[model samples]
Structure formats: structure tokens, C-alpha cells
Target: MFFRKTVPVALLAASVFAISTPMALAAGKGEMFMGQFTTEHGTTSHPMGDVHARLNPTTHELTYSIHWSGLTGDVNAAHFHGPAAADQEAGVLVPIDGPYTSPLKGKVQLDSQQAAELEAGQVYVNLHTQAYPNGEARAQLIKH
Candidate 1:
């Protein structure tokens, strides 16, 4: 009786661990980042937008999706600027390839420094329009 109960309990525990291990590993495989854009965050007033990004640390690939509307004018340019605080500005770390329309989505591989800055929450997305050549809206990426 003792041997039978021990075998069943051991098998059950092993099965539970096997099922849960992959889930735990998958959860830890990547990090998510998000941001909300507004004229308030930019150098000029225009409109609002938002971004969602995922970073795979092992592969150093950053995938992102951005959406916006009602800006002062058409989008002239967009970029990811980094290694700076929210109130400060920095040079572009990544240039968003265009048509420069809304709901932009893409992926890029990051260098070590860029990956570090992104992971540290020192990165931001900026949208520029014809009216606000500097920036129409901005959102700082925050890790989740």
C-alpha cells in the first residue's frame, strides 16, 4: 500500500511540474513596454497617440506598434529617441520607416547600448508633423 501511494504521488507531482515549467519559462522570456502619447509630452501641441512594444532580451529584438490621429497635420517623421529622462530630449536612436501613417508597426534589432537604454526606460517615441516639425506628440516607453 505504501509503495502504491508513493508512486502515484510522485507521478502526479512530476506531471504538475512538467505542465507548469513551460508556462513559467514563457512568462519570463520577454518584457513588455508601453507608452501614451500627448502634446503635453511634446515640445509642441498637436494630438494624442499610444505605443506598445515588446523586447526579447535573449535575441535583442524590439517589436512595436504605434497609433495616433487628429494631429495638426500629416506625419512628416517619427522616431524613437533615447537615453534621456521624460523632461529632457535626446538624439534619435531609431528612425521609423515610413509612409509615416497612423498605426505604425515594425521590429528592429537593438545594439547593446540601445537595448540597455530601452530596458532602463530611457526611450521615447516622437511624432513630427508639418505644423510641428519638432514634434507633435511624444510618449515615453515604460517597461511592464
Candidate 2:
């Protein structure tokens, strides 16, 4: 009787583990990426800004929040520029449409290539202002 019960319980536990392992693997873990914007990182001079973002690997969804103060002038645009290093420049990969105000928050769906670049730490955030059309502040997004 002891042997019979032990064998069945062990088999049940093994079955459950096998079933759940794939589900957990498929769900994956959420990845975090963050950056701090500074005039030193950009082509022109301006005040500081910050960005925090999360990427859901399973869904390919990216959610972000940004805050800034003391810019040279009003912000006109912002973007995630990528496939480049912190010291390098690249065309915009994702444009941040906005009322151009502070404490910006939004979400976007990233393609596989964009997601891969972001995970590889080749992406950066940029905020553009009237005083600095190229970009007022910039920061490289580092994965955490």
C-alpha cells in the first residue's frame, strides 16, 4: 500500500511539473529599460529628463513614462532612436507623438527587430525642443 501510493503521487507530481514548465517558459519575464536624458548626450544644450520603460517579451509591448524640466524651450518632439550606441547617432526608430508636455506616458508595439535592438542596448531616447531641433536632450536606454 505504501509503495502504491508513493508511485501514484510521484507520477502525478511529475505530470504537473511537466505541464507547467512549458507554460511558464512561454510567458517569460518582463524586461525593464531605462535612460536619463542630458544635454551632454545630445547635439545641443538643454536641461535634464528621465525615462523608465518596460518591455513584455511575450507580447512585444513597450510601456514608458518620461519626465523633464528646465528645457531651453518648448518640446516639439521626441523619439526612440536606435541600432546605435550612446556616442553614435541614428534615425528615429519610433516617434513619440505628443501634446509635447512633461511627464509623458504611453505604450507602443515593437517589431522583432526593434525589440532585439532594444534588448541589445542599442537604443536611446531623445527629446527635441524648438531651441534644439536636432535634439535638446538624449539618453541611452540600458536594460535592467
Candidate 3:
């Protein structure tokens, strides 16, 4: 009887501690942001897609998923361009891994500045193709 009671109490204490630990140790979790990619939104008009991304400030990781279609030709490259406002242009900030195909999923480790840019809605994902070397489809990342 004593062993049974002590075991149950210890387990209950352990369970309670585990549950509360995460909350107390929680870091600054960021928000999930999304964007609709389209040709008109880009510098050209040929490709379209959607982008979903989130920046985890605690880990300094940016996770992204993209689905694209209607690309004029084979995808040549894709990247996250940054520090540009909507309808404006900027340089590439992060190069996405290629053989670029639809429903792409990837993660990138971002620095403090990049995380700040992402939170500020200054980052955009752009897809480049044979026809449009600049950008075929683009979308501005916005915090939701």
C-alpha cells in the first residue's frame, strides 16, 4: 500500500512538472506568415503559386513551403528577396535549393537582421525561369 501511494504521487508530481516546464521555458515563438504568389505580383507574368513561412525567433529558423504552377518553362532558380516593399524590387536574400519543383519544402537558418526583415513584411519569394530571368512569380511575405 505504501509503495503504491508513493509511486502514484511521484508520477503525478513528475507529470505536473513536465507540463509546466515547457510553458516556463518557452522562448519567443514567432508567427506564421503567408503570401499568394502570382505573375502580376512579380516583375513578369507567367508563374503563380502560394508561399507559407514562419520564423522561429527562438531557434533562428525560417521554415517555408511553396507550391507553384504555370511556370513558362523549367524552373531555373528561386530565392527569398528582401527589404523591398510591395511593387518594388530587391536583391536575393536566400537562394532556395533547386531542381525547383512544386510543393517545395525547406528551412533556412536566418540571422537577427533577416528575422527582423521577415517580421516587418520586407521579404518576398521569387521564382526565376528561362523566360523571365529576373522573376516569373513573386509574393510578398506578410505576417498574419
Candidate 1's residue-wise lDDT over 5-122, tens digit each?
9999999999999999998997778789999987843444547778999998988888999999868788889999988888888989989888887889998888989999998889
- Please give, for residues 1-144, the per-residue lDDT of candidate 3 as tens digits: 999999999999999999988887565466798998877434434566789987887876888999988777877899999988887889988889976878889998888888899899999998888888887888899999
Q: Candidate 2, residues 1-144: lDDT per residue as tens digits?
A: 999999999999999999999989767667999998878434445477788999988787889999998788888999989899988899999998798788999988889999999999999888887768888888789998
Per-prediction TM-score? 0.77, 0.77, 0.81
Q: In candidate 1, which residue pairs clash?
A: none
Q: After superposition, how far is residue 53 of candidate 1 from its true place, in Å?
A: 0.2
Residue-pair clashes per candidate, as listed?
A: 0, 0, 0
lDDT of 1 at 121: 88
Global lDDT of each model? Answer: 0.86, 0.86, 0.84
lDDT for position 103 in model 1: 85
Choose the strongest candidate by TM-score: 3
Which 10 residues in a row give candidate 1 its minimum summed lDDT? 40-49
